[model samples]
Target: MHEFSIAQALVEQIEAAATKEHAKRVVRVVITVGALSGVDPEALRSLFPLVAEDTVTADAELVVEPVSARVRCRACGREEAAETSFLRCSVCGSRDVELIAGRELHIKTVELEIDER
Candidate 1:
């Protein structure tokens, strides 16, 4: 699955960040997974460890925070939850809409531990 590649990339990114911060160990990596990001959270979670072997992120806790789909209607100026692949205003039934959320995959936080060595 492509989740392995994604996980590998994620671990590499975490390692880079941890190294830049001079961290002794990476304790946690919190990520926000959007509904429309097309990345399966469960698959990513299962594949993370495989790609993290021998890395600073090997034992880091991977916390996935899901973001629900949402859109902003241009006609009605209303923001509401939406289904994936459907961008319509529930109130005004307008096809003209702007995506406000649910299409992003962002690393929210990285919890690191520094050892006084």
Candidate 2:
């Protein structure tokens, strides 16, 4: 599954960050998952631990924040949350709209442990 690849990539990134920061251990990783990003959160979560094995983030907790799709209507200048893939302006019933959010897959935060010495 693609989620395995995504998890693998995530572990790679985490390992890089941990090494850069001279982290003794990784604690947690917080990421944002957009509704339109096409990555399933549950699947990603399931694969993360397996991919993280033997890595710096093997014991890290994964936190996923889900974001809803939002669109701005071009015809009526209306902005609203979208519930489906077919985007339409709720106020003006116009199909011409621009996606404002909910298309991002990004890491928000990483918690790490460092040796006091």
lDDT of 2 by residue, 4-116 (tens): 88888888998999999999889999999999888999999999999998888999999999999999999999899987568889888999999998988898899999887
RMSD, one per candidate, in order: 1.3, 1.0
Clashes of each: 0, 0
lDDT of 1 by residue, 1-117 (tens): 787888888888899899998997899999999999889999999988888878878898999999988999999899999988788999989999988999778888999998777
Candidate 2's displacement at residue 115, Å, is: 1.1
The TM-scores, one per candidate, come to 0.92, 0.94
CA lDDT, every prediction? 0.90, 0.91
Q: What residue runs in model 2 are displaced by over 4 Å at the alpha carbon? A: none
Model 2 TM-score (2 dp): 0.94
